[model samples]
Target: MKKITVLAGDGIGPEIMASAIAVLQATASNYEQNFQFNNQLFGGAGIEASGRALPEATLQACYDADAILLGAIGGAIGSPWEKAKQTPEQGLLALRKALNLFANIRPICVPDALLPLSPVKEAIVKGTDFIVVRELTSGIYFGEPRQLQETKAYDTCRYTETEIARIAHKAFQLAQTRRKKVTSVDKANVLATSKLWRKVVTDVAKDYPDCTLEHQLVDSCAMRIVQQPTDFDVIVTENLFGDILSDEASVLPGTLGVLPSASHSENGVSLYEPIHGSAPDIAGKNCANPASMILSAALMLRQSFQEEKMAQSIEDAVFAVMNEGVVTPDLGGNAKTDEFTAAVIKKMQS
Candidate 1:
């Protein structure tokens, strides 16, 4: 049996994750795979229980499991203790670093049924399918030499040859499988780190000669993303840039609640999560959408377990549900949260 750790975190997290677990159980049974899930606490609940955002026990559970599924983290409620020291967001960042999850893959594709909801014209979004391969470790976000003075603060942006090579290689390999094209986004013209990034990625591209490669300045890439999103296939960039671009690209699909992301390690340890936050405004309300969480489970199956058929079944079911006009309020459909999840489950069983 494959062991999996489920972190049903704050707010709408538990509700949405419950739906994902149900789908996974059905998929595993149909595929004749034995799977066991071990639930653990993290985020706000973890902080309240253990005085730390990421407890040692939670980390151990993640290490022991074959894969991890995380619902959203953080909550609007502030802890009575040191606010900065007790925030739940730290738990997520700490867990990511501890697991060595260096690659984050975020796929953004506009479902055919939701084209009308897209801000972009239908013709521009008709066949828009692309994936963002982001370097999760070793970049400006975690770079060293960060310091704050009495009046000013500074953070260093750093990268190594190996860090660039690994993520670049992943991007090229992904390009070879998908569209035979890769766009390396960097600010090489301005930053020394990006120059190193450009040099290293260019060197790595030679290994995958069949995969066409190009480098674009980050500013221009950001502009073109909204102007001509369909032109992109696979986008590879550093942590900070990828974080901004992926969020921007998500708007093309109309709702942030519909996107899912996966962060993985070299040894196959993976964590699946939605891109959106714990919207404290809708904390206990059933109005929050669960599609992103369900999609994250699909990514967990595909990237970690290598269950492509089952993963595709989940994806098709989601699309079919939306195509039939059954959707959450966020997607402009009348279906309630339970109703939408039930539709997906029904489609999966059918």
Candidate 2:
């Protein structure tokens, strides 16, 4: 049995996590694959329960688990960081560091079913499939000597060669599997960190001769994401740029509710979560989209347990259900979270 730690964070987190769990259970039953899911407190829920976001017990559970599936965390954007105590996003960042999850893989694919919903023209957004490989544990997010002064506050953005190399290698290897194109996005023309990023990524590309390597400044890359999205296959960049660019790329699908991400480490334990955050406004409303969380579970099965058939079946079931006009509020459908999840499960069982 695979031990999957479930962190159903704050807001709509619990509801969507329930959907992912139900779907996983259904998939396991159909495939005869045993899965043991252990629900644990994290994010704002953890702070409320134990005065700490990444509670010790929860962290321990994650370390011992085969994999982790996380629902959304934090409040409606800026609200979580307003308080003096640790924010949910901070806890999440800490979790990434503790696990040494250096590579965050976000796949942005505007499938044919989601074409009508996309803001971009169908001729441009159609068949737009790409992956953003982000350096998760370092860069400005973890940089030292940061201070919030009364007049001038600043955060450091630093990286070592080793840090840059591993993520670069990850992107190139992943590109080899996809379209053999790795586009390293950075502000190389100005920033010192980005210059090093471009140089190191270019160096790493030499190791993967089969994979074609190209460089694009982060600004132009962001513009192209909305203009010529299909031109990119694998976008590799530092934590900050990757964070921004991936969110920008998410717009192609018309909503963040359909995107799933995986943060992988050298060790076996990895994390799967939706690209969207906790919609505090919609918490307990049963209106949140559960497809992202369910797809994150699919990513967990495939990447962690090597259960490709089971994973693809779950993903196919979701797409099939969505194509049948079953979607949540964010997708312009009226189905509640549970109802939508049940529809997907029913499709899987059939």
Candidate 3:
């Protein structure tokens, strides 16, 4: 039996996660796979229950489980926790650190059905499928020597050779399994940290002779992403760059509501989340899109449990549903959250 931790966070989290759990349960039964789920609290909900965003019990649950499926986190509703107190976001960072989940993967693809919805031309957006491999644990996000000077604010942008090498290794390995091409994004023209990033990634490329590697200044890469998104196979970059780029790349699919993310550690602990945030404005409305959450569950199956076929099944079902024009309002469809989710689950079971 595979044990998984379920953290249904604030806002529309619980509602969407309920649908995912139903699908997972149905899939497990249909496929004859034994699966166990443990519910735990994290984020603002955790803060209310335990006075901490990431309670010891939740961390322990994550450590004990094979993988984690998180809905969304954070909301101004009924929470006095300040950002400086290591709020909901910190819980995510701490969990990533605790699990050594150094690699963050966000795959952005233009589903054919949604091509008309994309801001870019139909021809340019038709077949764009690429993955962004973001180094989660290091880079400027966790860089030391950061402090506020009396007159100026300062934060370091540091990357050790080892840090770059590890994430580079993962990117290369992924490239081998993917399109055999890797684009290392950095600002080598300006920042010293990016200089190191370019240098280390270049050196690491030598080991993957089967993979083709290129370096792009972060600025140019951003432009090319919109202009020629299909040209990219896999993009690897630092935390801050990835955070920005991933959000930008999400538009290729025509709906941020359909994107999913996975954070994986070396020891097999993984966290799956939708690329979209908690849309408090639409909370409890039964109209928020659930595709991203469902896709995140697919990622959990693939990365954490090593159930590739099951993961693919879920993904294939999603594509089938979308192709049939059954999607949520955000994708220009009339289906409610439950209706859309039910369509995906029906396709999964069939």
Candidate 4:
């Protein structure tokens, strides 16, 4: 049996998580896959209950689980939760570090049916599908010597050859499965870290002869993402660049509410979460979209459980619902969170 730790964090987290869990149950039952989901407190909920953002029990639970499925965390602005000594985001970062999750995979694909909903012209967003393989748990986000001083504040962006190679292999391997193209995004034009990144990735690319590798400066890459998103197959970059670019790429799907992310370590429990944060404004309203979270569960199935058939079932069910114009308020539909989830579950059952 697969032990999956479920963290229904805060705000619309619980509502969306409830929908995703229902879908998981349906999928598990249909496939006869043994799954034991253990719900736990995290983020603001953990803080409220146990006086810590990531309680010790929650950490231990995650350590023992085969994989983790997380709803969004972090409270809204002006709330006491945001002003706490240890923020919800700290908890999330801690969890990532604890698990040693190094590769963050975020896939962005815009279906033709949702073209009208996209801000970009229909032609531009048409056939746009790509994955960003970001080197998580490293780079400036975790670099040392970070300090705020009287005259200036500074952060370090560091990467060793090993860090660059492992993620490069992941990007190249993923590219071989896709369009056989990998675009390594770096600020090599300006940063020492980027130079090492470019060199290391180039060396790694030699191993995969079938895959083509190209390097792009982060600025042009950001522009090209909006200008020609379809041109990219897989983008591998450092933590800071990936974080920004992935958020930029989220717009291509017509809504941030539909983007899912997966972070995996070489040896440890992996994490699945939506790129979107807790929508405190819409908490308990039953109007938040659950697609991202549901898709996140599908990612867990594919990456952690290696249950491809069940994962595809979930994906196809979600696609069928979206194509039929059944979605939550965020998707320009009036269907509530549970209503939209039920529609997906019905498709899965059918």
Give candidate 2 misplaced runs (Cα > 4 Å).
77-81
**Candidate 2 structure lDDT:** 0.90
Model 1 whole-model lDDT (C-alpha atoms): 0.86
lDDT at position 233, candidate 2: 95
| Model 4 RMSD vs true structure | 1.5
Candidate 4 is scored at a TM of: 0.96
Superposed by TM-score, candidate 3 places the C-alpha of residue 114 at a distance from the truth, in angstroms, of: 2.2
C-alpha-based local distance difference test score of model 4: 0.90
- Cα-based TM-score, every candidate: 0.95, 0.97, 0.95, 0.96
Model 1, 95-118: lDDT tens digits are 888898888998889988779888
By TM-score, is 2 or 3 better?
2
Per-candidate RMSD vs. true structure? 1.8, 1.3, 1.9, 1.5
Off by over 4 Å in 4: 149-152
Write candidate 4's Cα lDDT for 1-350 as tens digits: 89999999998899989989999988787788888999999999988887778988999999999989999898888878876666798888888988898999999989776787788888899999999998988899889989989999999888999999999999998998889999999999899999999999999999999999999999999999999999999999999899899989888877878889999998889999988899988898999999999999999999998899999999888888888998777778898988999999999998
Worst 10 residues of 4 by lDDT: 78-87
Best-first order by lDDT? 4, 2, 3, 1
Q: Specify the poorest-scoring 10-residue window by lDDT in model 2.
A: 77-86
* CA lDDT of every candidate: 0.86, 0.90, 0.86, 0.90
Q: Per-residue lDDT for 1-350 in model 2, tens only? A: 88999999988889999999998887787778998889999998888887778899999999999999999788775664437276788889989999999999999999888998888899999989999999999999999999998999999999999999999999988998989999999998999999898889888889999989999999988999999999999999999998888888888998888999999998759999998889888898999998889999999989998999999999898888889999887878898999999999999988
